[model samples]
Target: MNEAGDTGLAEVRVDVWLWAARFFKTRSLAKQAIVGGHVDVNGGGCKPAKTLRAGDRLRIARGEERLEVEVLALSERRGPASVAQALYRETDASRLARETARAERRMVGATAPPKRPDKQARRELRRLKDGG
Candidate 1:
């Protein structure tokens, strides 16, 4: 059989893999990310149709977080979270970088208001906006 060893599968599209791997909520979103150049394979940008096989490396930029992963398996159909996670193996460096970035973001976010203002605060803000 092929590398993934599931029903003799051979190829899986990049976008389909991303979605099936739980990187994107839907296939359309994965396609959008691919078309927007946020997904790369083997150190270069690739089309959504690019086939991914076992051992292929991927660099994905999702919002402010970046991920580097190696394809451990291939699946064209989306599955449960636990199964989806099995499709790829994230590099240690990528996980560490993501954690560090999240920590920094949390630190910076501490300066912002945690929740919406109460009714009185809204009235005061409205008054200020009206210049009165």
Candidate 2:
């Protein structure tokens, strides 16, 4: 029995762990994000192959959402949502910030115009573009 079997994991690659934790849909996406400098570990940038263990701190940026999480466990294989959730614990501040930003976006978006114009509206737009 190895350490992996004894404790589920001894350590895991940062990108692999992110994918296993469901942060990224695929390992390739996780690797891309890591290589692009979208992830930080222990307040410092790390390579995709960086080894992560329990208690490690991770700052991950996924588009409009940013997360600060403390590693709680490690796994090399992706699992169900409930299982994945156990692998890391999110900080309250990170959760609050993400929710607040989402709320603000919703409030501001309510007053925005529809994404696509109607046929009549397009004609009007064309006329305006043509300077009458």
Candidate 3:
């Protein structure tokens, strides 16, 4: 067990810390993510019970967004997002990569044509092409 006094610092369970830090709506969700293999601590995959400490880096994915953060402090109680943001700092590279990927996905989706065909329009086009 980490005996580090609260300079707002210490090692704590990843699931608990994630909930306290407002990364998820609840501790159970964080645990689910860990078990689902979506959370990485210190550049390695970890269980929900894994201990996290100050300066340890984490890679977490929610939907299409991936977050990379360095733990700065530990907490046991849930907090506001602003306070949670203070508990960890996001890496610039991760932020940029997520943003770029999201934008590219949006562009590709927007440029793609509709897959379904309208019955009347299809018949009319066929009639014209066949000179009928």
- C-alpha RMSD for every candidate: 4.1, 3.7, 4.2
* lDDT-best of 1 and 3: 1
Candidate models: Cα lDDT each: 0.88, 0.90, 0.84
lDDT of 2 at 39: 100
Cα TM-score per model: 0.81, 0.84, 0.77
State in Å the error of residue 13, model 1: 0.6
**Candidate 2 on 1-132: residue-level lDDT in tens?**
222212467788999899988999999999999999999999999999999989999999999899999999888878788888888899999999999999999999998877898899999999999998
Q: Show where candidate 3 strays beyond 4 Å.
A: 1-6, 115-132
lDDT of 1 by residue, 8-119 (tens): 5667999988998899998999999999999999998999999998889999999998999998888877778888788889999999999999999998998977689999
Candidate 1 or 2, higher lDDT?
2
Best by lDDT: 2
The CA-based lDDT of model 1 is what?
Answer: 0.88
- Residue 105's lDDT within candidate 2 is 93
| lDDT computed for candidate 3 | 0.84
The best-first sequence of candidates by TM-score reads 2, 1, 3
Which lDDT tens digits does candidate 3 get at residues 11-46? 689999998888899899999999998999887899
